[model samples]
Target chain A: MEVLRLQQQLIELTNSLFQEGFLDDQFTQLQMLQDANNPDFIQEVVTLFAEDSERILAELTKTLETEPIDFKRIDAYVHQFKGSSSSIGAQRVKAVCVDFRAYAETENREGCCQALQQIKQEFFLIKSKLEALLQLEQQILAAGGSLPVME
Target chain B: MENVDGDESQPGREETGNLQNLLCGKKILVVDDNRVNRIVAAGALKKYGAHVECADSGKAAIAKLEPPHTFDACFMDIQMPEMDGFEATCNIRKLEEIAKESGKIWHVPILAMTADVIQATYDECVWCKMDGYVSQPIEEEQLYKAVSQVLSRT
Candidate 1:
């Protein structure tokens, strides 16, 4: 019963993520790569994404505050952030990055700052959601239940 | 934990998939400055049975491509710290020229792998003589098509 409940929770959370546009098909591709040979592949990749995103976000914030603001430098950091987010299939965050880049390209300081805050919020939202999903998977495993396949 | 699926005809295949064996026995080099991208790209290639190796930077990739190269193809990231993909590809062309002058026919196909697949990036890749380009967050079909395109040409 415990395993079944966790499995139900897992499926619901996974579906919600996809439905809410927090993730995309790329996330499914990431899941597909995991197998017995790499049971923790998703966990490893998500951890890396979290660490890398935080660093990039920090750099963007600091660069935005500097005088003679280097839009080029901020764009580069945001570009990296965009790549990593999309690599992990973070759809909403990646969408904000697209807007962020356009603002940087045109030297729109106000737009850039607003987009930065939006991107940060989206990143944090997805990060916690991913954490919850991973936690449910862990619980299911502990109860000797295999993860349910997401359609 | 019993092996339930007994469709064990292809013994050498790395993972379970219809796409298995598409890149069997092919050695691929993945060049990227970002660690996650390297792992993700390598994971995708390995799924199709390719022997995937990685270089964290363009300079490292160049060093790996030294005389008597063995990689069947290379997937190079366009942006890096010291040496970008275009510069690396140029340097590689030079090396190939040297090899050609010595009467050794050699040209390991190079493909540009970038997150930004804009027209400008594509134009620059062609300008640098890259064989093909595949955008990042690589799709399996797209990657396979690009890899095979270059592999068949060589």
Candidate 2:
């Protein structure tokens, strides 16, 4: 009964994430790759995404704060961020990064700063939701229940 | 009692299993400067039963190609601080040439792993003599297909 309850919670949370545009088909593709041998695959990837995103965000903030801003370097950082976000299926974060790169390309200081803030907000929002979903998965697994698969 | 056979029938399991079989006992090197990317790539490769090694830079990757360390293939990331993937592949080809001259005859396949999915980027990889290409956020099937294709050429 506990397992069923937790599974329901996970399913609901996952649905909400998709409905909210925080994720997309890529996330589903990611989940499809997980298996009994690599049970913690999603969690591992998400953890890496979180760590890499935070570091890139910090570097971006510092880069934008400097005088005679180096748009090339900023673009490089944003490119890395886009790769990581896209890899993990953070659609919203990846979208913001695309916008960020456009600003970087034009050397638009104000636009770059705005994109950074938007990226940060989207990244944090998804990160928290993913963490919550992962926690629910843990509970279900602890109770010897398998994760609910979405079609 | 709830039937838990769902996990067994999850999508991509069969393909993943076949790929794992193809990679079993293979010696592969994962070259990347980022710790997270290294971990993710290595973890996925290791799961497929490959003996995976890590090189944080292109120079280190070249060094590892020398005596006492041999690999069947390498997954090289495109961007790094000192030497990027293009330079690295060129250097690796040089090493291969030297080995061939010495009668060692090593033809290790090197795959370019990157997020840049433009036609120009792929053309650049081919120009650098990389055996194949795999994009970032490496998926199991993509990794398997790339490695398989490269190994087939050798």
Backbone clash total, candidate 2: 0
lDDT of 1 at A65: 98
* Weakest ten-residue segment in model 2 chain A by summed lDDT: A24-33
Question: Which pairs of residues have clashing backbones in candidate 1?
Answer: none
- Score candidate 1 by lDDT: 0.83
Q: lDDT of model 1 at residue B129? A: 82
Candidate 2 RMSD to the correct structure: 5.7
**On residues A1-151, what C-alpha lDDT tens digit does candidate 2 reach at each position?**
9898888888889999888878866577677658887788889889988988899999999988889899999998887787667767777888898889899999899999999999999999999999999999888888998888787
Each candidate: what lDDT?
A: 0.83, 0.80
DockQ of 1: 0.30
Flag regions of model 2 displaced more than 4 Å. B1-18, B119-122, B139-145
